[model samples]
Target: MKHTARPSLLLGIALLMCACSQQPDRPPKEAASPVVVAPAPQTPVDEVQRLLARAARSDPATANDLRLDAATELADRGDTVRARELLASIEGARLEGPQWVRHQVLLARIDIEDAAPATALARLDNPAMQTESAGITRATQVDLALVRADALQALNRPVESARERSLIQAWMSDEQQRRANARAILATLSQVDMGELGHEIGSATSDDWRGWLELASIWRDLRPGPNAQRAELQNWQQRNALIPSLEPAYRELAPEILERIKQPRRIALLLPLGGAAGAGAHAVLHGYLAEHYRQLQAGESAPPFAVIDTTSTEGGFPAAYNAAVSDGAELVIGPLLKEDLQAFAGNLELQVPTIALNFDNENPLALPKLYQFGLDAGDEVAQLAREADNRNLHRTLLLADASPRARRQVEDFNKQWRARNGVVLDTLYLGDLNDYRVQLERTLLVAQSRERSDMLARTLGFKFESEPRRRQDLDFAVLLADPVAARSVRPLLSFLYAGDLPLWATSESNAAVAGNRSDQDLEALRFIDMPWFSSAEATLRRSIQAAGYSGAIERLVALGVDASRLQSRVGLLTWLNEAGLGGATGELSLDTQGRIHRRGQWYVFADGTASPEKARPETPDPSSTEGGTAWQPQEQAPQTRDAPPRITP
Candidate 1:
């Protein structure tokens, strides 16, 4: 057992942010369903006085508090003109037990707020301004100190940030006063990093409505949280958002924290089971479930996988998931279609951890405790980037495609790659790639021209000698275009800059034809992909009847079975560290950040059809075997008909 000599922030830091301020449930005014005051919007001032007078006669204890609160809010909203009158109207009244002190300070703050910094500092020095020493309300001191701090900081006083921090430090040193520090600090810091702050804000322990009200208020104070103020948060918010310094440090300790949060202990898998998705889902279910079960057989506790019929049942994910929870599955998996997950995301409460088999229609969207793992074209590009990373290919050139998704994929890859260690030289979006090779050759020759280099140099305030034989600084060329693009660009790029750069492609570049195989197009596009299947799963192949191929051949069609081989490759592996039988898709595990950290079978497009490490690597033949079509994809059907037609809810 590890010795707990002191609270190790390094270990799972059991931190729960307490936000006392909550915003009212008011939708935006410009939304289709805007909450317009049809008549007109006006401050309810007279109403406040009416309520106050009634309360004063009935419950003076609450009356003073209400009046004082209204005044403070008006002041905060910049109605300082009239807010001063409201505060003055209530300043003479006796408030309940501890609220009297808050009133005085809030009243003084209006003056403190209006006065010059020097005047505010002088006011703080007044004996009358200080809370009584005998038995001061705890908040009084804090309120005074914070006001003074804000005032000083506003006017460029000598030690505002430090002095405020020091006073808070002193307050926290006192055991009794320490209770609210976490809340206060969290409130202030949340303003800076709203997204970051939200990751940890769950329900608080207090049932008191006031606590919730305060959290609402604090949350509304969306200025900047302390975390946002930190040098690290500031840096990450600008760049490298995927890897916040504090988050990584915190994430490393997440397992322990996860161990403590009981609900997400369950996971859900949503895969299409029948119809067009059956064959793929079946194989995916085979590899992923097999791997997970294999781990369980090895004594690891695997989360339960509830194989719901996501194919047929168009409308029952919610009810079915509730049934799963009733039956003991903590999380869910399988809804191999986007519509089903969308349905669940819209209507169903996230009862358990859900790992979606298909991505949402919104590109690059995240679901609450919901992650998608599917075989999209982009996954292939990411795999190539990973391989490039391993090879230390720090500089890259991108040949683009017209597909919107492809554009975003390349864009994300460049953004992430640069954040990692590389730069994308250029991405050329083109209309037709039929003459890709010739075009690439000419483009490279021109871009590499001494004259062109000299012009570019002049733009950058520098000069390069007009030497034709000199090399270019670019390292790798990424083919975001499809197999068709590969057929042209590969030979052309190589013909121009053959020895200097390595060309990359998604598994789509697999162009191996069966009989009339040609080795021309595979000249330089060497890349990596998630393994969908390999030659080793003997019995697994026998299980798949039609499109009968040997286990020796790699298969990616099976990915749709469970979710899709693509989903298993990224999402499933990300949720768990288990291995899959991704022969063609490339088998390996992934982390939540979508990093392929483990080694998977790499199939270089030699002669085409994916050739595993042991298989003979042939030169890429444009018509030999299509990288994607050469290996028959799993032909599966959807799960069922319990679901309804898809429409935006």
Candidate 2:
């Protein structure tokens, strides 16, 4: 009975437990829904501002960093005032390493923007903020160095600026970065005076630095073509083998610096031997042959040469070129006419190098080894414009003949003069030498002055004894006239009461030979011509005459002689214009467009003869003098001569 009662109690207990467990499991409390709060969107400025506000509450150093970053952004956004205020709020004393550098660099940038280059330089001169510092990144160092270089440049310390730029290269590990820095330094050094630059290069403390500076200097001055540049680089390597630090830089530049130009073994001559340009072509040929013979007499080996006539009706230019090529000619020179040059423009599949004697009016297709050599009138006028600007002659009068050639000269002169900020007071085109008085009156506004004088006289009821004066605004006169017209026009200018005004003329204004009577009228006329024509050396004159070349053809003869000598050195001319080939024609340089430019000697008609003019002193800086009158004529012997007759083109 006790067991049965115990069992019933156990069952009752189990039932009670079941009832407690089954009493509807109260729904488990739902897990609290995650409070997903979406973050609010913010702009760059707002985010930076928030960062600044948070940093200020936590870390002072972090706050300063945020302030600097915000300042840079503000400055970039053209809010410089706010940028400066933010920058000023940063406690600079707490910054270190790259942060300190950033602080100083930002200040320097602001100073530079304010035109305080000296202040900018001072800020960047801290020794602690070094590029070699492990805490600073290479990119940051380069950027800092660039800003310093710019500050130096703005201060007119280009040498110092170049040195600063060189620092960037030293820190650069990337080849492209090094090359870009080197180019920047070279470009800066190019604008510095050669003498000053040489001094700066010589003063370098390290052999490596000196080597780099020298390389840059050579590159800046010579601007050598691929072949010439390779030669120069090779020469540099030979001389600078001791500079251990420069090897990597040089090796990296080898590909860009090394290219080869084929040496011509045989050459063919082309000329208009029987046409309007026949005389000029013959003179050139004679000169060329004379040079070749001269070289042979000097025990030098001469290249094999052949002649092809472009004027021959039997075979044209193409046939001549083909025949020359077939004969193993590696080079050809000729086609001394614009039409001939234009005709050959379409023939781009030239087998070998060919130099044309004339240039097409339009830009021609750039074929391999096709060059143009001619006495370009446009070059002369451009040079004249430079001379005028150098002398500070701001206002000029242009008097040219009515011919097409003269008109072209005037147009080129006008374009060049205006390019230099010069003012063209007036331009006069004269049809006849006899009409000089009328043209001068109109151009000089003398007739208008005279008319005013008559009106004044009528109003006053009396005529003044003094004649009406010419306009005083003209600082100089450029006369593009033939010798005949120049002879007549020069004296006419004096009679027109303009003798006191300075006059400049082109080579065409002077005669190769003139009588004393004609020379008397050409006194004070300054012109430019080839050295072969104006050389005072009696031996040179005798040699030229002995060669049977004179007058208008003398220049062409000189051109031919230069062409022959330059055959082997044409690559040099293409790159190094400042180091020109000292030719009989003049200092000759070949431009990138394949045109030869000759810088001629200046001369003045004196004592019934033309004499080489002494080089004038360097013109004073316009800002250094009152009224900017830097040009003053040197006293010259008074002489005159008749102008030579015009040559038909």
Q: Best by TM-score, which number? A: 2
All candidates: TM-score: 0.41, 0.60
Q: Per-residue lDDT tens digits of candidate 1, residues 302-387?
A: 45555766555545566666776777775566556676666754667766555565665474445455655556665566666765
lDDT of 2 by residue, 466-516 (tens): 344568899989989887777766656655656666778888887777455
* Candidate 2 vs. true structure, TM-score: 0.60
lDDT of 2: 0.63
Off by over 4 Å in 2: 1-263, 362-365, 418-421, 432-434, 447-468, 514-517, 534-541, 576-582, 586-593, 616-649
lDDT of 1 at 602: 52
Which ten residues in a row are the worst by lDDT in model 2?
A: 1-10
